[model samples]
Target: MPKPSSISEKPHRSNTSEESCAQRPHQIVIVGGGIAGLEIASNLPKRTGRTSIAVTLIDREPAYVWKPMLHTIAAGTSDVSQQETSYVAQARNRRFVFEPGELKGIDRQGRKVYLSPTEIAGRRVLPERAIDYDTLILAIGSAANDFGTPGVREHCLMIDSRSQAMNFNREVMARILETVTARNTLNIAVVGGGATGVELAAELIQLADVSAYYGAAGLRDQINVTLIESGPNLLGAFPDRVAIAARGRLEELGVTVLTGARVVAAEADCFRLADGRQVSAELKVWAAGVKGADACAKFEGLELTRNNQIVVTPTLQTTVDSRIFAVGDCSSLPVGDAGKPLPPAAQVAHQQASHLIRHLPRWLRGKELPTFTFRDFGSIVSLGGYGAYGSLGQFGLFTGGFLRGRVAQLGHILLYRSYQSQLHGFWRGGLIWLADMINSRVRPRIRIPD
Candidate 1:
């Protein structure tokens, strides 16, 4: 309703405490509070006299926003306030201690992790500290891998975090306003044919349509979206027909799809391809691939992949240490006798977290950990109003077929809600869902970032 504020403003902390547990309970330290870490902390049994462990979750951010929803955030179609899970509040409610800091290094022999100083509002908020653990879990998640492309770090935008998504929305809004003022078109280039890139391109068109409906009619016809992919088709992981359907859907929505296009370099306003094609745009987004956080490479003597993902065993334990476990996109563990690591998806992390929940406590009790397995279940690709498509099974024993239109979209929403319900109790989750539905009706359809 008012002019949007900058998301770069220091995040406000809430319900935070710096004190450690008084009792000498077995310390279970969790680094990185993404989906896996949050679920693991929430699902842990409440501390009673019976239990003798204290769970501590550490992360750089004060809140956790679902990574999959970043596209909608970038498009200004969703407000983050209702979605972001506050780490401090979650810790208080779930009986875990929350520490905000970036991982500096790990001492494998000492069973401790060093955290860099945490700064807020241009001042030292939390000083450098060390936390010890009987068992440690690393679920720090992954970041966008520019893959040595020139000028990419400076020129390309990535929607990998809440702040990044908010910044992207601001950029999109600024571009739209400029286009409206100039009565000209604004071209956007999105690299990668993966789900993020495809979903983002589609969501931007929806943003244009929403802007047109709400007094930005002059800018509706001025937004041009170009999707570039190095692969042969969109959604390369999906079946050929499904990928074709996704590409066709985007094309039907006026998106320019360039398949088999390799981006060799990124410039301020243009990207040079391997085939000598240079694509010009006002804004460029890189969402092709991901690697573990930069700090993963500094984990003492931990084994890591070329992309910096920690090498882990089938039980999700790091190859170098059994006490330390990695999950989500940051850890590379083999799957299905394929000699390849598990796919980077939230579902994989979710299932893995659930498996750890069953085994982690016992693992601390001298029980041997069992090998972890994953179920494919299926993959769903959203195309906004154009439609959604998904396959039921490609990896697991369960076989499934393609789902289209509302059915697929409904599945997408339901899956997200179920995740919320899993974290919060059914009653509270239902109330939160109702609140979101009500907010959609009461608030503006398109919201600028803060």
Candidate 2:
């Protein structure tokens, strides 16, 4: 078996004599082991008696971390390792092949995907390689869209991935620790009114408290968190009441809520707003928006939306190629009369993954594929330990009522737990959850990197 971080360029060949070249298994390659990709890979059948199938999952990272919890990871209040699911272990248990590499390019006509060499410390770990596939599924997900803002690319930190989150955590920890001697305010300005920005603001306040508990006493008082949103309010995706509650909750926690504040540019020490006012801060985070990853632009003739997301049909197949499918935040699937695409969210990805899991076998057997219909179960936002709020949909509520406080918090947590259960099976998933609960009791929740 290959190591967790290793990738083999050679084609997977069967050792049995009965499996001849004429009867080669169908090759299914999934790129990006994110919420959708990993879920589909874990649930898809390993093989069918009449028609054999081979599954290979490729990801840039060796382990998968719930993307929704990235705010906590960036705040240094969560143990990252405890939450990550190793792709190698998952692949081994689920009967699929795992490869670690970044998708650099794609060849639609040749049915090949190009991967960049994996490197660590400026040294080569694995050479660049290509993988063949009879059918391809792209779930590469979204990245922080800077919207061509000046200095944003250079001055702001984005928590789009695990590495980016860790980098921000390190800087935050260092800056907070320095406050002990400087006796100065540790100012942080977060751009965006969405869940990412709101959650991050709340998590940073909690982080300040945790830091004080560890050693940096009075850090909470010395920290100033400002959440700037161009929109009229935060959590715009939810109902007005929910947004009002979220804004009120955040303001109560000492977070400066700035609505209708459009940031025109980012500088080393401050953000220049549209109204000529500047918000000073030592750390700036841009979680204002997300777009399909940059790599999607180089997908070799695949049709893409204005935001660089691959265009897919209702069946989740690429517009130009039936054999290639796209899902999650990376695919642009139009809905309703406006033809607006679905927002990039974990629930959207989860539903799409579930759709493919149930229908991919039919596709493999040369049957018709069903159109994917996304069911929005509503939105939930966690305000650290302060509170949580949600506008529950019919699926979430019996008679349709809003969720608040601990109920909403539990719902937010269960969202992640459900995905883990889907990927690791209920028995092991329950055990994993139990272990985490036990560990939380004995271990420190705050993570300080050495």
Candidate 3:
């Protein structure tokens, strides 16, 4: 292995389009190429008059995937290839730079971030390089929290990223086929009753139906799905009635909903409950909880919460440094409800991104920084394509049954489209939407490789 480059070192030139840009303008480095980071790069008031800030968006992956749709990918309802936006392409179009590298460490005093070199097939493709920034924005998302359970890291699957979701989808299909061929029962254990867990459980049920239709035998009856929640009810964040209804729906689908059951240990083939009960499962999915990216907590001199999230003030600036702002799942900011930190949801991230876009330009010009107040617009958890349940605004809990569920589905689809509109202009977004609609009708529902 070669020695890593320092933060001040320049990257070796390649034929890549990102490297072809001649000017090395004043920098505003945005970490994590997720929704929040991409939005910030896209909407950063294109450097006017005396103010010119060249935005450099960095991430481990080369492309940006809308994470809210990961559950759909796990269900084989959405193809990752179709949904992902190439960060390099987007940066070129939007007049920014895109660096595909994993964040290794940060030097706040030096205003620089050390990035690990990217490699492929045991060959170094991109050398370690760093870009100096006047302003640093951390939008790196959270990861599935294992809670230090034994064998979880070695055995369970987490649906945090697009690749993980796709891998799980493939594993699920393969498991269904294997069980069908062997004419044996296949059990799935989902740990966590939050929105992602509940939504994925519902989607897995749908996938079973799809598999049975596509000639995967014994799937309809032999498939056993179990949901384990530490709380007394699923969707604990929602109203009691909503939680009750969701649990009822899960039970109706023949899923074993185990409430107030915590997994103390996990093995390759099974998990041990806190109460000394053992659940046998061929495949395990852990959606239990989330913590900020491990790298975020490692940033030098940054204040972090108990959950390893960056401690940010009301204006979303890091407690140790005003030049650094942390948002999305990586930041811990005060919430109105429960007087605690808000849960890491796509809604909160979208709100933060929008808020920052509105006020960041003013702050960049030595003006007043806007305080971020997160308004609870409420949340809607999709129960696969069957239905959705949750509340809207301050209104009482609303349940979408059948036709209304489709409306909710449209709303969910529009949420990502709205993000796309922010990245690309509305006119271009409309064109993309039309193309996607036409392609959806023509293409197969699931991806098949030749």
Candidate 4:
């Protein structure tokens, strides 16, 4: 992240029809184009003849990729180019302004946000600019929190973003190649037994199988993966049966599962456990917890939680400034768990974003914003190509049931497709799904990077 730039410049005012755009309450800036931000911008009207609201979405990256698919990218099972959607095209088609820059700070009193210059490949792309908005929405999602453990950040890789996940894939492939050439065993340690870690461990095994198919036979026997969970069970959020099944599946795939194994610290090529045991590995990954970006602390005066997540009310409005809102992994809103903040999940953010599409227009009319309620549709944890488990509950309905196998796996894929459908509409989303299917059968194994 860059330092906060000057806020002397103001955003351009809207000069559209008076009925469609308001002059004073003109710009509505949305920071972060993750699942939440993109959905809101796509659903919100670009121009309602009856009102004025100029929408602007700013993010450090120029594209959006579903966060859950990051593990696949990390395992070399998916391509980043195929998974990413161009933000500029989305903005142009959806009727919003797209600004590419990293958010550094916010001027709450002045109603403006400071965006630092955008850089790519060590080259400057977009210069710093100030975006003034009567209403600002922060959807800047989270990153993997290492809990300040010694050597965690220095030694472990995380799959919290597209780039990091891709980097992990490259590293894994490079290590596998090294082991193949040296005729040695490759050890891998995935910390935090959460959904991401579990999925990643399983996917790595599947990736090894694919590598064998691509002329790297005997790679599987040379690769060893360990999944470490501090909790008593994997997928602690899911039912015990789901956890048992997931652990069983991983074990069947030859993954070493370590429960109640808390990592006190990470050293180069090894992790020190709380019980004084050490787990050695050639590669380590941290997927333990979620926390807001450290850069968000520079937002100046907004109320934030210990994790640096913006503290928001039930309506997703920032506690300190009603004009500013937050959702997704970046928000800490007291919605459930005895006034504790809601879990930072994709579903939570999706529901909140949907609620605003209906309520934002009312907000512009000076009417009361309706409260939001989150209904969990359960969860699905896919164990690579072997199987998936968990439960699915209907949205706003009275039906729920446990699921497994292909149905569960398809359910996971459907959840991602639902988001794509929401963004690109049904026709395009359907086509993309078809294309993915075709590519799966027709495309050969991915080529590992050097």
Cα deviation at 204, candidate 3, in Å, is 1.0
User: What would the TM-scores of all predictions be?
Assistant: 0.92, 0.93, 0.89, 0.92
Clashes of each: 0, 0, 0, 5
Candidate 2 per-residue C-alpha lDDT over 328-421 given as tens digits, one digit per residue, 9 for 90 to 100: 9999999888988988999999999998888777666667777888887888999989999997664744635688999999999899889889
Off by over 4 Å in 4: 1-25, 46-49, 393-400
Number of backbone clashes in candidate 2: 0
Model 1 residue runs over 4 Å out of place are 1-23, 47-49, 395-398
The Cα error of candidate 2 at residue 221, in Å, is: 1.0
Instruction: Evaluate all candidate structures by whole-model CA lDDT and list the values in order.
Output: 0.84, 0.87, 0.79, 0.84
lDDT per residue for candidate 4 within 1-450, as digits (tens), equals 112111122323343433443335467899999999999887777434466777899887778889888898899888777788898999888888889888878887666799888888899877888887777889999988888899998899998877788789889889988998998999999998888999999999998898888778899999999999998889988878788999999999999999999999999979999999999998999999889977778888888889999987777787766778898999987854578787888898899988888777766765677677888898889887989997765565534578899889989989999999989889989999898888778875564564
* Candidate 4 local distance difference test against the native: 0.84
Deviation in Å, model 2, residue 272 alpha carbon: 0.6
Better of 3 and 4 by lDDT: 4
For model 2 the local lDDT of residue 351 reads 96
Worst 10 residues of 1 by lDDT: 1-10
Output the TM-score of candidate 1.
0.92
Model 3 per-residue lDDT tens digits across residues 16-39: 622433354456899997778888
Summarize candidate 1's per-residue lDDT along 1-450 as a digit string, tens digits. Answer: 112122122222222321332346778889988788888888875523355888899999889888888899888888878788899998887888999999999877666799999998999989999998767899989988898999899999999888899889999998888888889989899998899999999999999888887788856579889999998888988877678889889998899999999999999888899999999888999999889988898798888898899888888887766667898889998766568888889899899988888876665555567788888889888887779988887665547678889999998888889888867768978998999999989988888534
